[model samples]
Target: MGLFALLNRLFHHGPAWLTFLVMGLAAAGLALCSFNLLFLFQANYHLLFTYGAMAAFDGGLLQFIELTAWGYLAIACYVVAEGCLEGLLTRIRRAQL
Candidate 1:
């Protein structure tokens, strides 16, 4: 009985820890992406202010597109993190049953 209880606790906590780790990583990724996106926009805006609109637009267009892709990637990471939590919750609920 003691051994089974110990094993059960280990198994239960292991997945919880794993879920937290994954969520933390995903949050970090999202923060990095958001910071980069803001930095890029600030730099582009500076360029536009220093240079003319036409010159800035010529170079900044590519940056805008790249940021859009990164934004999507950040969203994907968020979704994955949410899904992981949801899956973990479902498992816990089924175990309780």
Candidate 2:
């Protein structure tokens, strides 16, 4: 029936509240990607122009003090970058709705 078709299209493709859920999952996936890359570049890898990662749990927070300021800074920067990307995706879903 036309009525069922209309409802189906609205829920499936047109603006609807459920779109927010899909957007959130997408944001999480993106953030995870960012976290992995950050972990790789700022901490994990050691190849030309790269420094090696420190054992985060070795001595706990106290050991953080031994890191160069840039190393410490990268940790904070990565968190913010990932959070912002998630927020952006959330807003995008709301906008579409």
- Per lDDT, the best of the predicted structures is 1
User: Which residue ranges in model 1 land beyond 4 Å of their true spot?
Assistant: 1-16, 36-53, 56-58
| Residue 6 in model 2: lDDT | 55
TM-score against truth, every candidate = 0.60, 0.31
- How far in Å is the alpha carbon of 10 misplaced in model 2? 32
Cα lDDT tens digits for candidate 1, 1-97: 9965654443345567776677678878888777768777778667767777685568766766787788898897787567657757767898899
Model 2 scores worst on lDDT over the 10 consecutive residues at 44-53
lDDT string for model 2 (1-97, tens) is 9965653443345443554444455455545444445444544333322422334444423333433444555554454445445555656787899
CA lDDT scores, all candidates in order: 0.71, 0.47
- Displacement of residue 23 (Cα, Å) in model 1 is 2.2
